[model samples]
Target: MRISAVRTADRFLPERLSRQLNPWLLRLDQMLDGSTEHAVAQRVSLIAFLVRIISAAIALVSQVIFARWMGQFEYGIFVLVWVTVVILGNLSCLGFQTTVIRFVPEYLERQQLDHLRGILFTSKAFALGLTTCIALIGAGGVYFFREAIESYYVVPFLIGFICLPMIALGDTLDGTARSRSWVLVALTPTYIIRPVLTLVVMSIAHAAGFAPTATAAVTSAIIATYTTTLFQLLVVNHRFQAVVVPGTKTIRFGEWFAVSLPIFLVEGFFFLLTNADVLMVGRYMEPDKVATYFATVKLLALVHFVYFSVKAGAAQRYSELMHTHDHAQLSQFARDTARWTFWPSLMMAIVLLLLGKPLLYLFGAQFTDGYPLLFVLVVGVVARASVGPAESLLNMAGKQKICAMVYAVTLIVNICLSIVLIPVYGLAGAACATAFSMVFEAVTLALTVYNRLNITMFVFAGRTNARPVKEEI
Candidate 1:
């Protein structure tokens, strides 16, 4: 009883379309439930990718308004202040936020809800206290040595302090949310709502004929940071109540600190390596030059962010795979994750580079002057993506000490190169320094992944008679 096919002028259209989409469909299938571990990683990574694109767009628009409203000098100050707050705020998480994404997922997978409850409260309390202390101490030290830092950064630096606690608080909420796969809850407030709020507030200020300086911009940032984080806190709390008991047993504070300390070092060093060039540029060059250099880095960051988003998604999977003790499955998951990181990243890099000049031009004519730096920065990004988030492999594999060492060495090299080159080659020096340091980081992460995990962390994924990476429980 075969049914007759209905014929039309477009009879084979569905078949043609499916044929065209089959590869993507197969890839999607591979990404989903190729194994439970891989599926989790792929889904989180995909969501992070989509969210970051939205975030990047919102951030780009905000910066454009910031640049126009503040003028070059004032805009440069805001960049410096904003970057400072971001680094410190992320740092102030004390590694607990990201650590939660790691340990909570693993503990929960092991049905260690008791431990998960402990981590939940412990990480938040510790991050809150630590960052608050750091901000206060930093402010005190700055007050004492007020004559030390450059004149322009003083006010901006102080203003940046209001954000550190808020940022750190937001990060903890993000980690908790992501561990549970509440992607929107984890990302939206910080990435989307915060920027939108910042821009809206600043626009209102400018509309009222305010000076619209860095101070004004920073006031807006402070408002946005607190507003979004508080909102996230309330929403996350509501969700938390449904899943976790209010009176769950808490882990020992000492135990929590012990686990987070190494992670703290790893994160601190990583932050230093990533932001060293920008910090150094601000130190050596004028504020306006910093604005240009930061703009260039942001332009090239589209590719870099892909590698990061993949890392964020895959790190948890790496941890879960380690728990399985199945070498074959672990290697397959590793290879699949790496492959996911590479080809898509390469395509995205191509697209970003093509549009980079125009985006830089969005900052204005003087802003487009740094377009040449994009090529220099892109090399590092492509090279790193070539290895497919190798750093995550090391971090999740209990090689945080080695990771710290590698970042330390790279940061020093970056600083020395930036200092030497900037005086001679200007912004090109900073770009060159950043590229070289990133290449160094990729090489270090590749070796760590290879020696520790025995997987080839590279663009090329097939067999090479690779040996298994050894580690202790």
Candidate 2:
């Protein structure tokens, strides 16, 4: 009916507008048909892009409110602790969050329901258990070093530890949902619901006369994280039961871990590479400066989300193509993803840079000082975007060890450069360090993909010869 309507409208529409509308309508029709791999990936990428847009708005609003309510110092403290918790929570998954994306599609392709059920259950359990242990260790560490830690950060850091298990669980569920192309289910809990809930909880606490301190913000976060994750657990499990029949589960712990550990190293290094600048700035600079730098990074998320949205949508497709051994399709899709990632990122970076100083001023006037850092940081972001999610491709294709090695080397460069530059040049130094490391990461990953798979992963690369396929899954 919709197609009929579109056809009818196309007959009456002016040629100029119809030229524009026709291509998009045709693409929509292709997506609605859902027969081709390219169409499916495009649809999924569109959904992920929309979700990230909404999430970015919510996060921006929430961060601005927190900055206003707590002032720069307290907000900085809260940002530092919260970043720590999130990083640790994601790390505690030990790569199961991502490994699920690789294995679930392959298992289903082979009609291995037992393995599918096994992974779904095991990933969540492993994440919850590991994160819980990490949380306990974190609490103990805080207790043992309370006196040595800053008086203001101690309690908030302890409170932040309580959020780890839930955060980890949410991440695993996110991957599980993504593996099935449930974009809303995959992204909503952590990205949309959690930030909104945090703001609401914090607002209520403040209205009730609670002090707007780092501790209060962390308390609100704890409540929000638990609420979001438990609800996600119920929804995800219910959806899983509907799709996967009840049966005996097969737990392939050894095989899963063998893949996961290298992926863990890749992710751990990637996370540290991305966030090390902020952490180092926090270490050397005062809270206000930290707050300023954090705000700049948050503003940059508008541009960064393009890469993430593409990665989230593209990973499962990469795994599927690998399973099918369709090298031609895989090569085309990989190049398509790089184009999808780079152009939008370039546009968003330009728009954000135009509005960046004003956006930082929304956090506080002093934040405008960090606006110049945006120019430096965006170079690396665009550089990384030039390769799209080639790393995801590598991981799904059983090249995780090499990918991990690439990220590890990039991270070392980032850390060493940051250590030397941040103390000397402050935020600008950190930005330079991060951007340079990103360039290094992108070049290395592109070369790795080319060398191992004979596929050029860069956006601007021309067409190439297709390689003979010998591997079978």
lDDT of each: 0.79, 0.90
Error of 2 at 255 (Å): 0.4
- Those runs of model 1 whose alpha carbons end farther than 4 Å from true positions after fitting are 1-35, 464-468
Query: In model 2, which runs have C-alpha deviations exceeding 4 angstroms?
Result: 1-9, 14-24, 469-473
Write model 1 residue lDDT over 48-104, tens digit each, in one string.
888888888888888877876676788888888788888888888877876787787
**Where's the lowest-lDDT run of ten residues in candidate 2?**
1-10
Q: Hey, what RMSD does candidate 2 come out at?
A: 2.0
- Model 2: per-residue Cα lDDT over 1-473, one tens digit each: 44543475579988787877877777777876665877888888888888889999999999999999999999999989999999999999999999999898888878899999999889999998999999999999998999998888899998899999999999999999999988889998988999999999999999999999999999999999999999999998899888888999999999999999999999989998889888989889988888999999998899888999999889989988888887888888889899999999999999998999988889888889999999999999999999999899888888888889999999999989989999999999999999999999999999988887778888997776789643313
The best candidate in terms of TM-score: 2
Listed in order, each prediction's TM-score against the native is 0.92, 0.96
**Lowest summed-lDDT stretch of 10 residues in model 1?**
1-10
CA shift of 371, model 2, Å:
0.8
lDDT of 2 at 399: 86
